[model samples]
Target: MRTLSRECGVTDADNPWLSRPVAPQPSAPAYTGAPTARPTGPSAPQRGVPAPDRAALLPTIDQRQDADLWWLGAHGGAGETSLAALIPGWPAAGHGWPRTPGAAPARVVVTARSSMSGLRAAQTSATQWAAGLVPHVQVLGLVLIADAPGRLPRPLREFAQVVAGGFARTWTLPWIEAWRLGEPPALTAAPREVRRLVDELSALLRPGADGTAN
Candidate 1:
C-alpha cells in the first residue's frame, strides 16, 4: 500500500501567504537493528512455517468415518483402490491420517509397496503413528504390497523388517498380474496370503485395545 503524503510547504519567514521552498536536509545515518537472526537450526522451524519433514508429508483425508478399519495408503500408488476393491465397503485414506467422528479413535492399517521408496514412505507413516502426531488414532499394523513379480531385494526386506517393528504386525501381499492388466481385484481370485490378510484384518478390526487378534 503506497500511501501518498501531502507535504505542506514550510512557512516562509519573508512571505506569510505564499509557500516557501525549503532546502533538503542531510540524510540521517541508517539505524541498524541487532544482527539478523541466524537462520533457524534444523530442529527449530521458522515462525508460521511447518517443519520440512512435516511439510513433506502428504495431506491426510479430511473426511471423518466411524468404520472398522481404514486402509491408510503410504503413497500415491500404494494400491489403496485395489485393496478397497478386495474388501468392499472399507474406506481408504491416501497418504493421510483417517479421521473418526467425536472422540472415537481411527483404526488404521498402513498400506505400501515392498520396494525401497515404498518402504520408506511406510516408515514415515509408521514413525508418525508412533510419534502420536494425531492423538486417538490406532495403527493396527502394516500391509506391504509386492512391488514387482519377484521377491524384494535383500536391503529392502531388511529395511522393511525395521519399519515393521513400528507397528504391531505386518502383512505381505504378492504381486497380482491381473490387477496390472486392469482387471478388478474383486473379480479375480485373491491369493492365499491376501485371503489371510482379509480374514486376519476382519478379526483384528475390533475397536478394543485388549484381546486383539494375532
Candidate 2:
C-alpha cells in the first residue's frame, strides 16, 4: 500500500494559514461502503479550471463509505461532483442543504476570519450543492475542502487556514493550483523526497496523536 510522508500531512509551515493534510491513497476498503448516485446533465464549466473530464473519473460509491473519511479535492480540477457522489449517505442534518435548525453544521470560513459577505456566499453555495443530494449525516470528520483554486480570493485562503486548524483531516486538491497557472502541476513518478512528507502528515491524522481526533 502506498503511504504519505509526515511532511505531506500539513500545509505550508512558513504560512500556517495554508496548512492542510497531504493527500493519501488509503486502502480501497477505507472508503468502501454506501452507494450514492450522481446528478446527471451537463455541469457548467468554470473558466481557467482544467479539471479531469467528468465522464472519465467516476468513483466507486461503495469504496467511499468503507473509509473513515474522504477529502473530495476535485473542485473544478476533475469530476468533483462525480467523486462526491461516491458517498452513499447524504450529509447529516445541519450540514445538508437547507440546513436544519441544528445539524452536522460545518463552518465554511474562507480563512481565520472573513467578512459577512464572504461567509454568506459560502453558505449560499454550500446550500445549493447540498440541496441536490440526499439527507443523512455520518460526517464525524469534516470534509475540509476548497472550491475553485483558480478563483480563490485572498479571503478564502485565510478561511481555509482556519478550517484546517479545526479539522483532523484535510485534502488539498492539486488542480486548483493548476488553475492559478494555466495548467496542472507536474507530478514526478520518483517523488521520493515529496512522499516522505506525506507520510508524516498521515501520521498526524490518526487518533490520540496530535489530539485532533474526530
Candidate 3:
C-alpha cells in the first residue's frame, strides 16, 4: 500500500497529525451480525441548516440491524450511493450523520472522486472531523473513487498525495465500466483491489478481527 505520509515527508516528528502506517493483516470472516442500537430521541436541528427529507432516506438492508459505519459523500457525484449499495453499511449520502434513534456506529468513512475539487472537499471534511468540528462521528479515513480509468495525471496524482497525507488511511476504488452502465456489483465480478478493500472493511466491522483503525 502507498502511504502519503511517507511520500510527502510528513513524519510524526514534523507533523503531529501524521502517524506510522499500520501493517495490513490477514483476512477475516465477513460480519453478518446486526449492529447494536443506541438511544433514540428527537434531534434539534442546527439554526441555519435545512432539514433533510427523512422520507427520502435510503432504506437499510435490514431495519432491525444497525449499521457498522456511516458512509458520507464529500461532494456531489462522489459515488456515495453506489458504494453504499455495493458495500455493507449505512449511507448518509451528503446528508448529515445518521440520527435515527438507535444504536449507530460512530465510525464514518467519507467518499470523494480523485479529481482536484473532490480531493479538496474530502480534505476539508477530514480536517473538520479531525478538529472535532463534526460531533459524534469519528472519521475513519477516506475512500477515493477514480475519476477515470488507468493512471491519473501528474497534477491530480500530486493533489491526491497531498490530500491523502492529511489522513491516516485512504482507499482508492478504480473506475468500473459496468457501474457506469448501471449494473449492480457482484463479488465475483469485482476487481481484485475492490475485493481486497471490501475484505479490509469487513474485517473492521467484525469483533476481534485484526483490522486497523486510522
Candidate 4:
C-alpha cells in the first residue's frame, strides 16, 4: 500500500531548507488559518513510534508550583516555549512526560513544527500516548507551529491529518516573523485566533477537565 507521504507526494526534495528544532513561539499578529483537524481516534499500527522511559523524563515539579498546565514539545524547537510563555501560567517540558511523584497526572499539550520530522515526532508522541506508553499526563491536544512563512505543503497537510487522529484535538499556528526575531506574544495584544485559542485552552484547563475536545 502507498504511504501517506507517498500518497501525497511529499519527498525530501519538498523540504530542502529544514532547520534545527526548538520550542514554542507565539505571534502577536493576526492570522486566520487551518488551525486544526478534529480527532478521528488514535491510529495505532501505522507510523507510530515506540515510547520512551517516561519516568526518566520527569524532573519533578514541586506540588506547590502554581502552574496548572505543561507544554510538552513533540521534538526540540516545536514551540512549546513560546506557547508556554503565551500563557504566563503554563510551563514547557522539553519533550518529556512531566510527572511528580504523589501528584495527579499533569495536563499537557504536545507541540511540533509543521515540518515532516516535527510532525512525525508529534505522531510518535500521540501514538505513544494513545498506546499508554506515556504516563502521568493528560494530553490536551497537538499544536503545529509553522516552520516557515508560507502555506504548508499539500503532502504535509495531508500527513498532518493522519497524525491528528492520535489526540483529543489539535491546533496550528502561523509563522510569525516577529517571534523568529525574539519578540514575545501577549494575549491582550494578540490576534483573534490567539485570543480564541487562549479562551479554549483556559476553559479545558480549568479544574475537573477530562481533557475532552471542545
Candidate 5:
C-alpha cells in the first residue's frame, strides 16, 4: 500500500535520497584572520566515498502517543482545519501541530464533528505527538445534535466507537466517564455540557494535577 504521506505528496514513494541515513558532521571551527602555509606533501588518492544526500539527513517522525483524540466538525467551511488558528499562545508556523509555548505546559483543544475534522485533527496532533514533547492529549468532539443524526459517519464512527459504543441511538459520555475516573476524556455530549467537558479535560491535562469528578 502506498503510504499516506506519499499519497498526499508529502513524500516520494521512490525517493533515492532516503535510501540511506547520513549522520551530520560537526560544524568546522571558525577560521581566524591569520593565514597558514600550505604543506609540501604528495596528494593522497581519492577512494570510493558515497555522496551524502540532504534529504537522508532529515529526521523522520513517527506517531507515538497513548492519548490523542480527533473531533469531526460540521462539513464545509473551515471545518476542523481552523483549529490550527485557534489555540491560545500557539505560534503560526509549520504545517503540523503547533509547538508548545515555553511559558507553561499547554494542551490543544479542537471541537468538530465532520470527516474533515479527522484530517484537521491529525494535522494539529502531528507536531506534538511526533516530537514526543507534549503530554497525553484528549481530543473532544461535540457532535452537533441533529434530530436524525444518522449512524456516526465513517470519519467519526471509529472515535465514537471508542467513546460512544456502537449503538447509534445512544448517548454515551466517554469524556465524562474519563473525567470522573481520572483518565483523559476525549468526547462529550450536547451543547450544555461542552464548556464543562472542556474545562474538565483541560484540568486533566494540567501538569502535576489530576481531574476530579462531581
Candidate 6:
C-alpha cells in the first residue's frame, strides 16, 4: 500500500516538527555590589590639602542687651545706632536680632533711610516681621529717616509710599543738619514731626499698652 508520506516525498529529516537543540543564552555579568565602607561626615581632604574653615563661611552677628525696644538696621547705614540713642531703645548692629538675657522686650522698630534702596530694605524687613520670620520679636513699626534735608524727589516719595503701605504704622523723620554733621539733635529743638514720633513711640511703649499706636 502506498503511504501518504511516500506519495508526497516527505522525509523525517525535512519535517518542521522535528526537535532541535537551542544554543544557551550568555550568562549575565555578575555585580560586585556597591562599596559598604563609605566614610561618614564631611569627606577627608587629600594628603597635604588644607581643610576649609567652616566657621568663617558665615559672618558673625553681635547681640547685646538693655532697653525695651530694639532698633534694627534694615540695611547698612540705616542709622540704627543713632536712632537707638535718640529713641531710648537698644541698638542692634546691622540687621542682627536682639538677644537679651532675661525679661527683655521683643518689640522691634526697623529703621531705614528714605532712599529707594533703603525703602526696599525696610519693605523686606516689614514683610518678614509681619510673617513672623524674626523669632521672639514683635515689630512695632517702621522708621524712615529722611535721606535729604528737603522734600523727597517724586520717585523717592512714591517708593516711600509703597514701603510704608505695607505697615500699619510708620514714622518719618525729617532730615536734621546737626545729625548729618555728627551731632545729636536735641529733643527740645527737634522738628514737630520728630516730636510726634517720640510721643507715639512713648505711648506705644507705655506699660500695659498694646504695641500699636495711633
Residue pairs that clash (backbone atoms under 3 angstroms), model 3: 37-103, 38-102, 38-103, 40-101
| Model 2, CA-based lDDT | 0.29
Please report, in order, the local distance difference test score of every candidate based on alpha carbons: 0.60, 0.29, 0.58, 0.62, 0.28, 0.56
What local lDDT score does residue 68 receive in model 5, on the 0 to 100 scale?
A: 19
- Between candidates 2 and 6, the one scoring higher on TM-score is 6
Worst 10 residues of 6 by lDDT: 37-46
Per-candidate TM-score against the hidden true structure: 0.70, 0.28, 0.66, 0.69, 0.30, 0.63
Kindly provide the TM-score of model 6 when superposed on the true structure, using C-alpha atoms.
0.63
User: For residues 1-214, could you state the per-residue lDDT of candidate 2 as single tens digits?
Assistant: 0111122232233222222122454332222222221112112212222223334332323221223333332122322232223332221122212222334322121111133343333323322222223232121222332343354677665554454332333334322343345443222321332233234333433444332222
- Candidate 3, 8: how far from true, in Å? 16
The superposed Cα distance between candidate 5 and the true structure at residue 197, in angstroms, equals 1.8
Model 5, 3: alpha-carbon shift in Å? 15
Model 1: colliding residue pairs: 60-96
On lDDT, the stronger of 4 and 6 is 4
* Model 1 / residue 169 / CA error / Å: 0.7
Q: Across residues 69-122, which tens digit of lDDT does each residue of candidate 4 receive?
A: 678887788888877767655777756777755456767788889999987787
Candidate 1 C-alpha error for residue 14, in Å = 84
lDDT of 3 by residue, 1-214 (tens): 1243353343444443432012442323355443322112111112222222334222222223345666778778887777766554444544444443454435667788998888877766654554344455555667899988999999888878677655546789899898889998666687876676666666565665433332
lDDT of 1 by residue, 1-214 (tens): 0000011122233111111022442221122231221111111111222112775465656565465667888888898878876654466776678766746666677899998889878866655554446555666678899999998889887777766654567788999888899987862387888766766665554334232322
- Comparing 5 with 6 on lDDT, the higher-scoring candidate is 6
Q: Quote the positional error of residue 27 for candidate 2 in Å.
A: 1.7
- In angstroms, the error of model 4 at 100 is 2.6
> Candidate 2, after superposition: displacement of residue 159 in Å?
5.1
Error in Å for residue 51 of model 5: 26
Cα lDDT of model 5 by residue, 32-131, tens digit:
2222212121111112212223232212222232121222232233223332222222211222222332332223333323344433333333222322
Best by lDDT: 4
Better of 1 and 3 by lDDT: 1
Which stretches in model 4 have alpha-carbon errors above 4 Å?
1-66, 208-214
